[model samples]
Target: MEARLKFAVALGAALVLPAAVQGADYFVTRQGNDANRGADWATSFLTVQRGVDALKPGDTLTIGPGEYPENVKLHGFGVPGKETLIRAELAGTVVLRGDRDVDLDFAQVPGRRFVYIADCKMDVLSVHEVDTLTNLAPAADPGALEFGPARYWHDAEAGKLYLSTSDFQPATCHRYTIGVLRDHGVDMLQCRRVVLDGLAAAGYRTAVGKEGLLLPTSGFMLHQTEQCTVRRCTAFFNGSGITINSGVGGRTDQPGEGKGNLVEDCRAFANRLDGIVAYNPSGETIRNCQSFLNQTYGARFYGGRAGDAVCLMSDVLAWGNPGADFWTKGGGLSEYNEAVLAERCIALRDCNFGNFQHGIIGGRNVYRGDRPHTIILPGEHEEFHQFNDAHFADPMNFDFRLQATSSFRQSGEGEAASGPHPYKADIYHVKPGGNDDLDGLSLAAAWKTPSRAVARLKPGDTLYIAPGRYAGDLALTASNICIRGRGIEPVVIEGGLRLAECRDVSVERLQFSGPARAIRGGNIELANCVLFGQSVEAEQVEGLRLNHNLLVASLRLVGCSGVILNGNLHAAAPAVQTDTRQAVRYSSYN
Candidate 1:
């Protein structure tokens, strides 16, 4: 037994030693000799395509800085975990360009003749134009070329470019500079564990029948793959930044099951449609992704038949989009499977709409479907748990400042458990005094108060109020400010008070009633208070600690804990008043 244990340990060490020693072997160089063997850095392949062809499983291809005029595809059937990565060696540019000035049918430009490259792990590849020299004409300037009616005459016999309108004329032609044009640029299909990092894909023209560049026509059109990541990459001047749909060519699959894909720290700008469209991708996460100056929606998801299942997005900033910042439209059967979880997502400076829009918005149980299909805010519901407040900046043409009195302030609920997934990194850290807590007024109206009230508190500072009708929305901030009313006639903290990012604050003997919703805060404590709105179902609060308080409307607590009710609090429906014992029943306290 001792001898066998020693041998096993030795074998384990031997296997691990080779993995540590082999540090990035495969390399693609634009200046190195292509004839040399592509095994070592001294003898590397000249083009990215050559290195991709020579790569084996578990090989890391490092592309050196230079311009390479070609589209490369990697199509090797390898096992999972033995994937390939093509990364840039440094912070310089590596261009992947297409062939220019190729004689082809000009009339077929509207048709689908595309320059295509697909199925590879592309990383840090920068593409641009290649400079070429051409002949000169005398009539046109010294180094110029002309192709219009004054320089050349057309021939009716052949439907092509000829010198003359008669039989033919001697044409003085000179070569001119044209940008490297690639059509239907790069496509990845059935490729798992691929990383597209630090690469610029540009100058892709429209093909004869195809509408745009990078046309991924169905059949795992960037789908059905697992554990793939597209990070720090830029997709600009394209029809769609990345159209991830399984049903583009009329092929249907399970809805919202695009699993284990991460698009993080990437930028998509100037696209005609959505920056990133994840159609029917389940368990996919997009974090720290920014989209700016896009024509339409920044990010849109159409979770197909199976419904969008467990899609999470965090720290997503969408600015200057003409449409909604984020849109999730469910497609097929409504089994409550379209679950979209967003955290710390901001839609600032969007030209059209802001953060979110749905047929059913606010609180998961707000919708009366058989299976409870509602938006989950940052609190606890009976069936679902909302962990964060999906915040939105000021809308277009709105002059709301992001001060203590803005809606975006105090918009988030208190922090909850990060969950069991490995990708639950906090994208937006709520600032100290940014209306995160529910102890005071709404953040949107904080600045409208007297400057004296705003300056008296700081982060985490607590303030108590006497029973009086305090007009206007009182904005209470500072990290730990505890505000409480003295008298029990329900110290009416009237007006539109908004609370933001202030935590660990308690409010007592307060009666909030006015044109605005009551207090919105994180980690809030409410004791002996009456939240009397015009109607019993119009208040929007993330988390509330209501004790001996009368809630006249429906209350929602998202992803919160330690809520205890000790006094008479009734759900204000006229039908339930007949029974005195039922007037004060035990509500669920998570």
Candidate 2:
């Protein structure tokens, strides 16, 4: 007798997309009004939500350069050829900020750098800078308030967000804003053949919803969506950067299944948790992406039923991250596990290839740094190769480009190159008796101002500041650059220094004085510097190090993890304060 044969029937009717004609193109601009027709740039829509709502099958929505503080939801669907598209007019110019503007009154605390408010209506994520959109970290306790600029805390029971404004008054500053908790930037739900390109999202946070669960926000979320593409996008400073999930873990129904998603050429960094996550995904493809300096995993693909199709994760760069760089975990029934093809990836730190009984076919991947590389279960990571001394062109400053002298530059047999990207790294110089018109290459022909030197730097570049006194405030916008002082004459800056929305930057042997904010930023390193007569506030920074520096000011850290303080000389007895749940590793602090 023949064995009984059973077939798994797919629930619900199959979604068949009908071919459509070319649709109209709508525009959204910052200068336009929401009540306009939104047909062209002249009469564009004001808000992103308006443009998103006007989208249909085969429709395209183009947004201009500006910040759109709206929680945009894209439920519009399209066919195979004429897909629904939402893109920026200029790549990397449009920003979707998940925050709201606010004006509040506060009273200054006695002998402290903080301000306080007793009663408030809503629980805010943090006090944000209106002009720069910089987020302040929430204070752990009001009683143990750290002396830092823009430190905040939200008392949920009393509905108060603690904000400290030492340089100005909170009520009259007119430069502060706040955001409600867990507001997602862009959510794609029940959509098909949708494409998101050249867009940026930030400022989403975690909050407790009314359902008594901790709800975390994503910069870009795709829920139960199929055939969607996200390319050339950037997500930073959110709860999670980009997430693709089926919502129901192993559901085989149409509404609970997600497949054929593509995420490529995207950058996700400085997020609170994982950079890019795909849960319960089927046939997902994520490639040519950079995920770095995040608090947790750089890329995580997990939670799929047994015997699912092979998912491809390739050409990914994961570096400067504290947690695991690339991780994969299997679902239930581990014997018949999800299959992942991970290749041509670069991990600067940790990489957990697979867990349970998942089959991970990995090859031509480069793993540098001293962190541990882990794999669970038999045959978890079969072809993974570790090069403890991989030669790259300035990997410290986020340049994963292979040099001409590197052995792994050329592929072996059928495999690709080892690293994730291909780019050049350059070095610049800044001196006292130099002109800004110079190319800033050699010290003999260097730039003059610190602002101009930093402006010319890209990721993975190093700027050498000569021994001199500069007078302008520095606001850094680029990430993964190093600024080092030259000579012994003391490279002094008589203004404030701010590094926001960036990661993996290092400053060495510089003197900062006479500024309220001496050194401030996320995921930065300060070593052998003089921070005098000011405050140093670090927010959302992981793997922060303050080493062998003369600190003559108040130091406050918020939301920082893996802190290292070694051989630092302090002017005061209790100058350092932190408001984090993580432990601080310190040695020889005077």
> Best candidate, lDDT-wise?
2
* Candidate 1 C-alpha lDDT tens digits along 1-590: 99999999999999999878553567777777777777777888888767766766567778776556665554432346665676766422454543233232222112222211112122211121122111111122211112222222222234332211111122212221123343433455455677656554433333326442223221112555556666666665444565554333324444322357777777766554667666665567778787766657676555453434566666676656667666555543222333555555555432121223221122222222332211223423422111121221112212111223322233346522221111111111111233423323332222222213544666544333433455555555544655544323334556644555545666555667742233334556567667676432212233444567676655543333333344447655441221123222223321
lDDT of candidate 2 over 226-302, digit per residue (tens)? 88989999998787888887544323222255678899999998777778877766778888898987777788776
How does candidate 1 score on lDDT? Answer: 0.45
The ten-residue window of minimal lDDT in model 1 covers: 128-137
Please name the candidate that would achieve the greatest TM-score relative to the true structure.
2
For model 2 the local lDDT of residue 255 reads 26
List runs of model 1 lying over 4 Å from the truth: 1-24, 95-182, 205-223, 246-258, 303-308, 330-338, 348-590
| TM-scores of the candidates in the order shown | 0.46, 0.56
TM-score of 1: 0.46
